[model samples]
Target chain A: MPNNGMGTLLKTPTGISGLDEITNGGFPKGRPVLICGSAGCGKTLFAAQFLVKGITAYDEPGVFMSFEESPSDLTQNFESLGFDFEKLKAEKKLRIDHVRIERSEIEETGEYDLEGIFIRLNYAIDSIGAKRVVLDTIESIFSGMENMTLLRSEIRRLFTWLKEKGVTAIITGERGESSLTRQGLEEYVSDCVILLDFRVIEQIATRRLRIVKYRGSTHGTNEYPFLIDESGISVLPVTSLKLDYKSSTEIISTGLPALDKSFSTGGVYRASSILITGNAGTSKTILAAHFAMSSCKRKESTLFFSFEESPDQLVRNMATIGIDFEQAIQEKMLLIQASRPSLQGLELHLMVLNKLLEELKPRTVIIDPISSLITIGNTNEVRAMLVRLMDTLKKKQVNALFTSLTYDGQSEYNNSTVDAVSSLADTWIDLKNEERNYERVRSLLIVKSRGMAHSNNRHDFIITGKGIQFTTSNKK
Target chain B: MKENTTDVVIIEDKLELTLYISGMSQKSMEAIRNIKWLCDKHLKDAFELEIIDIYKNPKLALEQHIVFSPSLLKKLPLPKRTLVGTLSDTEKVLKSLGITTEK
Candidate 1:
């Protein structure tokens, strides 16, 4: 009865954690999707997360077909992710069926299809009135079944039946050598093809996801890295193609008095994305929070995306330094959105930002240590995502501040990534921290600014209980 | 670098291939200078050469399948060849394209 459509179409939400945001509401709401990935790349985890999350979060009962893991093995593994499969099972909101497809155990002497797995899945779905389903690595039949011809047709039939059932299903495949999936399952699943990749770069393992194809609906075309932690799987929806946004011309203070004076216009323009690149412990988040407090004082909304610390701890720690975010939160002027960069892919983090911006309509957005995001993706991907993010912020006219931590303070001191957005940016601020003689000191520099004149001198500053008050001036 | 006489010239769309180079890095600039000199001296006008700096027009590189710098894409002719480094080697260049130098 609710009208949430552009025309004669409606959208269904996937209760899967961190997915609806990326798909802008989840797989076109009932279209079958192919989630193919390599072995031990968490295909089972990905499928389970979808089912468990659907049942618990959206009241959408789901059926999970496990071709490999026993139902109990899955229950125990996901239990660590805070997913109570047993509880959901008892609630009758969920169902799990392990289709024991041991080629040696079953003798297919005559012609046959995978109607057995279909019947079992249908029974589970019908019993629960399920709206979501998952076929976990069903392509393992490549190794399990000897008759490729019969199995292929059976797999095709299974997908078609899933369509007839009209539930949004996720069919996961093993990243076998022959194809992107062992059995080349992509040729069959038509709605959306999603590839999950687990790669090791510099000895650090990372998981990434990409939507290879999504028919009818427009989707982001970039590899989005995700992570599996205690909270479950977090997929980054990094690229947003929407350019519709508004930019504010008004300039706002960064809370540091002398720093404000150094700006040719006396302050940073609203909706501008400012990058403050520096070495570790350069007070990046602290400085961003200080400016946020200033904005909140002016009765403007601000959103802080902290990659390093939790929002509560950040607020509490800032309190020790005499910056109280509690009052701002109570006043509805400040909201800190904190998450581990490793918790999800870059896009996932960006989607959260998009959500917060839409909900809070903040005047400013702060990302503490954008550099950590670099670890999750390669150079090109990181640069491309930042450009999109910055472009989105500019369109929104939200004053955006991003902190990038670099190891070498003097060298490679500029923002680096997949693409160069410095040309697209309105202003850039660099924060530097080093031991000057025997005393450790912090300084800020205005690297580049478009449209308005800016002071070029680097000024020394320090953190004392009161806040980030500058020790240098540019007004003279 | 040469506004007077186009740094890149394609004889026609016959030159179906084009190598787009971008960036102000010493490597890219030096490679471009050499590609222009060597390509001009050796290949002459028989083959079309197009050189582009990505920094100036980064969007153009992605449009034409260019991932690295100082790349020479022999276009306007069928079957394109891309070289990441210098565009020297006279004998192979002519023989591959079935060209005979008058000199």
Candidate 2:
């Protein structure tokens, strides 16, 4: 849907992260957009960020006509997002008009239109030469005014007038039982319609955004998960439908010389995702720590997500295996984020990871025991999130190493995560703990390494104070 | 006519109203004529009315939070009231404006 040539539709870029990428180029330019959502779904914040970003990033003046909150309330609410509304107002780049429609104060009589509103809007727009406008929850007028037919016609005219005035407008509406909006405002704003939804699945709340309709332009139709934080709204356009990521030919270490020697190419490909699956206490975390240490040694930043242990605990535990992460942490080359898998839903975890990736711009990422994350989500959801995470890392050329814990007797083919990740991973290593001669010994085997040659033999290894050491191979 | 003229001055209570309209549109004209007729038949000379066209004074609309054209606001009376559209319903207008037409 790349718009080129003379027939390209003009677009106004909304500076929200990943939003312009999903909307193709933001909402249809100079047309009214309908944002319908249930209560507390971040609709107003989304609109406010758009207005603020339009002024700050694109130099486009904006008008926010609020039907619910007063101007002071809006200004105070948006202050946490780092928006200086008062300064923008003083600079004549922004105008906030609070339209209070109290149901108890008015008596509707004969034929009348909302001409005063139009005139006021015109005055406000002309006063600041605003190019963008927001009518936050304009549907409140329905509860205040008794005339439905007149209100509907006037609202329809408002949209037409906004387009005629060549200003991009966003009109928010509350979700209705039967329609997209309570008053079915989607019918009036046919150019673009975006729906925000907040759902609590298994007691974990997640917010999502979807484009219900975008006329005369193409958009991502999938329901993308969004995040609302102190900074603002960030929509993760996680639709990596095409397998178009560029592959790298450069080789990288396995962090252990014995493991590197086991591979035919000496090491795995750079930016390739590697999976280390093993039973309990089979040294998965130790191997991931080795990868992180090696990445930091090369001056590359690494992001490690430890679902099982705290950061200090992980650092102390890995220290016993001769992998010192303290220096790396001190050097700011390694960031370990430790949290329980059940602390939030799968989407929130992914969003946190995505946000960290954007902020840190790390080159290596390690997820210790991705199996714990599987316990919180269904099989399909975990797989979808894993795919998105892996695809994002691959697109950024970030080296990723994920460790999964398998049951003692479970077959790799029967495990849902193994089945899902084995196909996507560029390299897979299987670790096992076996008892022989009345003693338990550790072994490692190369499952698959795409685009490279590797040993198929199982090699026995031992963990010492120095690191993982190769002992003997039965060559089976 | 004699009773209405006497009723206009007998109360000595001033009724003040302001009509906010858009330009000189037909709705504005109709609202003006309706209110004038209602006042003549009811309050006579006791009421003071001023009409402000919103188009000429758009800032006034924003300042007063006026949403509809031809809106009548009872400014002087305690517990101020607002009525939108042409004042065609005589009884409802009188009651909402706190005027006793029966006397």
Candidate 3:
């Protein structure tokens, strides 16, 4: 209803590009979220993002209480990620207080409570009018204290206090054997839970995040890929069915009129997803740009999502191929966004795409290499994401085109991204780099084109200063 | 200011839970170490040490009712004597139960 406007935006904003949508307008405002992960799994970073994002985006002052590192250490370490902790502290909008739990300094007298911790937290929160609080690795207290009965009671008290204060707190704990936290902290914060995992698959490190639990609101269960960069934590929760949506119905050409004539119903259908599969250095990106250029020429806006290269690099390289991306960009007909796939999780990547699509409302959307995204997620997750994405594209009637890298060496490793989106796409095209004697030639083939009779033969094509063309065509 | 004494007999019974105390909080870790040191030094010989975890078993502590903490008791020792605070003044710890540190 957009009821309350900006003032009523209790949204946490997540500080991450696309996570807010899946979170249904950020995490449950002031409730606690249990962030459990093994050592060196980016637990502290995730907590830092919460505090940083809260201060910058929501204007909701925050306090970060660390039980591990000192405030100076945190500031220096996180400075690389563009988080000026010092600046935030100086502005009095953010406060970071490190509670060093030195076992030797603590003196157990009689009937003592955690008043010291409570006092420090309160001071920090109150100093900056903080609506958000973070207790990083507070479980160290269990080691510092001998009495579990008192410690357990105090932990519960701390949570109750945070709730009463109406601050959205993030309590990070080391992962336990069976329970969510090593200290069984989940036994406390039962409502919101987020689990971050950094696992190595086939010698490649990939970081994945998933909302394990969210109370009173719907959330995407899929594990989205997140990136921890100089900009802090960027979570890619997959796109949700937003209330605001738009559609298109005008079919765009493939930049080549002859190829467009091959469609039975007159070229590619509007809002239909086209899958173009090829190997590295096989003109996949160039082809995608050409298609976007065609859309731009039609005076319809187009968005190019490039993963293999940078936006500037893509523009420069495409200009060499006579694509004229500069003119398209100047005309506001094309937007080229490029970034490394490893920067964030696949879901985060999809979220970025979702935001870009929403803002730009491009008539034609192009993802240069879908294979990179496929590598970040499991088979089922990738399939589900692609189905949603294609559905969104079709509903918007924005003709979607994706380029996928395929391994032709083994049949088993062929077109994993294609295999993911093929069932959902309205058209599928395969680009092959085949060996003919000593000369390696590039060939294009169409596997299937729904609702149309497409050429089912492998035709060789070349990328010159002008454009791409084929000499032979075979069909029945 | 209360003087109470019991029979001078060593309760020869295996404790339901054999709790151990090793590290002393004197110069070691924290309250856990101090508590451990107190338990190790005093509490007589009736409460035999089983498994001493200055780290692991600290969280799984239960059944014996260790509320005040650093306190020790013989669940099987007849007339279970419950004690709190660091086990200093060894003689006082022994005489409180009408027994000597010697087995």
Chain B TM, cand. 3:
0.44
Best by lDDT: 2
- The runs of at least 3 residues in candidate 3 whose Cα sits more than 4 Å from the true structure, single-residue gaps closed, are A1-13, A239-245, A264-266, A269-272, A276-378, A381-399, A403-417, A429-476, B1-103
Estimate, for each residue in A1-476, the C-alpha lDDT of model 1 and write its tens digit: 11234533345565555566566566755667888887788777877777877777677888887777888998888888888888998989888876554332232222333433554566678878999898886876667445688778878988888888899898988776878787888999887888889887655566888888877665567676677766667765555545666656787888776777887778887777777766778787788887898888889898888888988898888998889998998998888777878777666676678767888899888888777888887788778778778877777778888777767634533546312545555677767777889988898888887768888788888788877778876643
Highest DockQ: which candidate? Answer: 2
Q: lDDT tens digits, residues A65-134, model 3?
A: 8888988999988989888898998999888876654353233443334544665676667767999899
Clashes (N, CA, C under 3 Å) per candidate? 25, 0, 9
Q: Evaluate model 1: give its lDDT.
A: 0.70
How do the candidates rank by TM-score, highest first? 2, 3, 1
TM-score of chain A for the candidates in order shown: 0.69, 0.95, 0.73
Instruction: Categorize the docking of model 1.
Output: incorrect
Error of 2 at A338 (Å): 0.9
| lDDT for predicted candidate 2 compared with the true structure | 0.87
Query: Which order, best to worst by lDDT?
Result: 2, 3, 1
Q: Which candidate is the best by TM-score?
A: 2
TM-score against native, each model:
0.59, 0.95, 0.64
Span of 10 residues, lowest total lDDT, candidate 1 chain A: A104-113
Runs in model 1 with CA error above 4 Å?
A: A1-11, A21-24, A28-31, A101-105, A141-144, A241-252, A262-266, A269-272, A276-378, A388-425, A429-476, B1-103
